[model samples]
Target: MSSQPYRLYYDRMTSAFVPHVMLEEMGVDYELVHIDTGVDAHETEEFRAINPNMLIPTLGLPDGRTFGENGAQLVMLGDLHPESGMVPRIGDEDRPAFLQWLFAIATTGHTTIRRYSYPEEYSTRYDAQDSVSEAAYRQLTRFYSVLDGVISGEPWFLPRGFGPLDIYTILILIPFEGDALADILDTRPSLARLHAATHARPTVERLWNFYFGADA
Candidate 1:
């Protein structure tokens, strides 16, 4: 592959930020094209041609092929460039746990938050939706707590470094602003250390400013 064989179509804000963060960590050069997701720009025919789903973080390969789903992207990126150190290669023993924790963020962490943010879409009864959202919040809290425990107990989830596990999991949760998540992690010095290190990394810091900037 050339230095940058793919272009990352993404929005600086929203869920796309996660992969944006990951791609920066990958250490490989990439062509980055940022777009506003909910705006008409991303909905234009040109953009839709790449991702009919109209989602951000759609990765386009060199051969005019493209794919979505951030989880799948992480796995593929891992296999294609293990030296990036952002993920474990396919046959690595850590792959299972790496995938498990990454998926947990999608199935458990993000799913729980969904109920809170869009209760009405998921339920007909407004009252029922409230209860569901509440339950989801509690579950999310617990899951973050579990992650806190895991990170607290180790230097890294993989016993290696911040690969796909941290990339897929932590980035999803960071979008939650004004939460006690950081406070809870503070209780776990080890986890806090890891989080701090992640934030301190050059790539992550660049992404933080690029993706989270007020102008972004």
Candidate 2:
């Protein structure tokens, strides 16, 4: 690894939270570059030069390569710092299940949440927004059901113990609020346990307060 610290472009409560937690867990030297999404900082040309996608959780590697996408960032960081044990090694039997959950969360889980949170982005018809959100909620519920069933480990998603998978899963769940969050947790015992376990970490608690405020 390069001696230079990794740079993480972040915005509070975004997918950046996953990598933020991962970096802390790895105990790697890193710098945080705050991108205030409230002001559209991520849309600026300056930020775009580093990440063409104009996304948060853009990682600036020690070698100067910058890329967006939190899932890829987690994979890269895990592979780069195997000593952290954040991911199962390529030949490890656990590696397959780890990748399965990681990619599922990154693609399906993330996409479904986006639809639920911002139905307008999926359609221009104002009247259609409710239906879109409702459909997304149904899909999300189903997704959580499947996720809840496969958690064979105690207080974590995999038997190997806490790692990137737990971080990524909790990231998707954080956006849910009020009855929505309650509904998910109340119905899924495993997911509720996982959520509690992830939040119980000191790193996660501190970062959550840092991003969403102590009262949150």
Q: Against the true structure, whose TM-score is highest?
A: 2
Cα lDDT of model 1 by residue, 1-216, tens digit: 544467788777656666666666766666777776656677889888888987777987655578777787877777787778667667877667778777887778766766767788789887798887787777876787787666522556668777656555556456366546666566666656666667776777777777777777
Q: What TM-score would candidate 2 get against the native?
A: 0.95
Off by over 4 Å in 1: 1-4, 124-129, 175-179, 187-190
lDDT of 2 by residue, 1-216 (tens): 578999999887677888889999999999999898889999999999999999887999999899988778989999999988879989998999988989999898998999988999999999999999899888988989999999877779999899988888887786687896898899899989999999999998898787777543
Enumerate clash totals for all models, in the order shown. 0, 0
Candidate number achieving the greatest lDDT relative to the actual structure: 2
Positional deviation of 165 in candidate 2, in angstroms?
1.1
For model 2, the stretches where C-alpha displacement exceeds 4 angstroms are: 214-216
Clashing pairs in 2: none
Deviation from native of the Cα of residue 123 in model 1, angstroms: 3.6
Candidate 1's displacement at residue 85, Å, is 3.3
What is the TM-score of each predicted model, taking all chains together? 0.83, 0.95
